[model samples]
Target: MKTLTLDLSGIYTAVTPQSIQAWEEKSNQYQQQLHAGTGLGNDFLGWINLPCEISEEQLSSIEEAARGLQERCDYVVSIGIGGSYLGARAVIEALTPSFEAYQTKHTAPQVIFAGHNIGEDYLSELVAFLRDKRFGLINISKSGTTTEPAIAFRILKALLEEQVGREEARERIIAVTDKARGALRTLADKEGYKTFIIPDDIGGRFSVLTPVGLLPIAVAGFDIRELVRGAREMKALVDESVPFAENPSALYAAARNSLYQAGKKIEILGNFHPRLHYIGEWWKQLYGESEGKDHKGIFNASVDFSADLHSMGQWIQEGERSIFETIVSIAEPNTTLRIESDEANLDGLNYLAGKRVDEVNKMAELGVRVAHIDGGVPNIRIVLPKLDAYYIGQLFYFFEKAVGISGYMLEVNPFNQPGVEAYKKNMFALLEKPGFEAETEAIKARLK
Candidate 1:
């Protein structure tokens, strides 16, 4: 209900009733295609949600499992790649600062991510840092045959065994892999390891809100219920189209696609708030991994305005016309930051005293608009009233659904990563076997 009332059609007078109806119709059609959108199920859009598929008991079980991880292990190394890792990392970074992962007095246990890559130096460092610490591994993969995480798992498991003893190590480890079988699943069963399902309906990228995300969030002591509830609210609202501005997610997706079709090739996801930088990263991966093939869509990149203004801001203002930025600018705050008065009026800075951050933000946004319009740049600003577990839940789901629709519109498979496969094949050929002899020979011939 609260979501159905928030206004957010920036620069426009108000959202139209007709517009809302169109979005509702789209949502209705999408509900049918959600599962069909990917090889997994309907809500498999980003491996998020099961549409009342998972029970409260299951959520509790995941919460308990996180506790188990905390109890038996000093750290957890999550081994997943692409969506598998990015979604969880988004939540982690959004809700918890990177510094808080391993510090603070009341730590919910430490987690260090590994196995997403196979660089020996990186793996060796993780192995070295975690040598004597009691750590468990939550190895994620559908096939269990993936090169990166699999290699990292083997190395980490060996180290875990040495530290906790193999039997104890097995107890500490958990496998969120395929239900029926995979190399990871088989190894987990043989080792008598703890288990969690990656879900038959959910894909790795979209699995964050499911056990995939729940495990890490619960393990980190975050309010997992709030997060899921937020997503649930988001899903419910996408189905309703009343009050045009209230449906922030639908409006955003549609407008973005409109901009892309108009020859905009880059989306700069800028946020004044540094905390939401990962929302941009999540967006980058979602759009980049989803629609970046065949050169059919705009490239998505992220920037924090105040910080990047010092570096990449110049080209954005004066460079060749290539981008349409989607700025996720929040209007309201979750909490009030005082606009404290300046007692000692240092420079002529007293004019800025007692101005609410929201006020300062208002002026900054106007400047961007003036500059962008003058420079012939199109901008679609995503204005969130506040950042909370629920609103972000809506935001993430909205983009994931939009990306799927955009891909289908592009006549491409948004779910599958055929292009990413090339890199993986090269990696395996180089790492597992001797090398890519033919490619190498070609290179040598070129040199000669």
Candidate 2:
């Protein structure tokens, strides 16, 4: 029953508790703005109550679609970028076995991702790998015209059709896109592919709870119901009515802003557990895109611990003092392994004999905290009771809610990513896309 909790004790050295507490009134005001649909990006606030709004029928439909994919394909490629695919991939990677690729058997189709980038070799290798495999596609895009996923869908759709024949391939592809418009929606309607609606009010990064994330997660054989339940619980806990003192999201938003004001410009999300790697990636996108605007947001970064302890640890310990760390600490691991007494003790790890591996990890995490704090870097700790579908759900919602408040505190539109299109226009012009003829001519002149 214990859910995600945030501890700001590690941050007290850098910014006083009173400074963080001062954000209480402002944070609550922002939370109210989100609820009342009065904020700058209020039109895209559908995700605020999404968990509670999702009816039983919707969950069942997604589950049914997932069941079909599970039954038909040995591998399922989830094609999209940013929020579209990060949420599902984060959850699946957290729950999946570390060495799943080497596993001899699987009860559900292995889910893979694509279209996040335009790497030719990556696509080529993916095509060659899937040539002989029983695979399917879940194409996610609201516009179905995003350059990366659109190109990927084109290539993969042809491959799947060739392998399974066009008629059967239609059944293998599911489209999560706009309800009534967009290229993907048009294609799905024409081709008769099973379709799910990506809500108009919900932006891509926040679309995880919708069919955009649910269908792929369910297909991965995880419990979507539990995940939604956890998010609903968090939604209630972080509601504007809750006292700021007891609200995890409010405190997190406040603490982060407090540090940012105190000259800590970079937040490095660190985790001791390896399975949670994508969670960091997802968190980075959530915070970075939501808050990194108006030239006034903290830089979000991440590191995988114990492993990065060797690589990034030195820099963190003695590098520039502008960075602080927020560590996601898991209290309990899914499995257990204890160190055993070795007769030779050749590695000198005998001192750890009879201790659970988690114990050493915990000690190392504590040691790092003390070292970092002493090294003048503030830290924030997010404790999850266990890593499961429910906790992951809670974690995702916690960050989502906090980032909304944080962005508001920083005076930026949390939901809109206007700067993301600058590169696209240039890329299209360089490629001589018809509509960009003027831009193409200008760019060619500039190059000369």
Query: For this target, which candidate reaches the highest TM-score against the unseen true structure?
Result: 2
Q: What tens digits encode model 1's per-residue C-alpha lDDT throughout 249-284?
A: 555655555556556678788888767876776778
Worst 10 residues of 1 by lDDT: 6-15
Runs in model 2 deviating more than 4 A are none
Instruction: Give each model a TM-score.
Output: 0.85, 0.99
Prediction 1 TM-score vs. true: 0.85
lDDT of 2 at 72: 90
lDDT of each: 0.69, 0.94
Model 2: per-residue Cα lDDT over 1-448, one tens digit each:
9999898899888899899889988988999899999998999999999999999999999999999989899999999999998999999999898998798899899998999999999999999999979999999999999999999999999999999999889889999999999899999999999999999999888988999999999998999999999999999999999999999999999999999999999999999999999999999999999988878799999999989989999999999999999999999988899999999999999999999999999999999999999998999999999999998889989999999999999999999998899999999999999999999999999999
Worst 10 residues of 2 by lDDT: 20-29
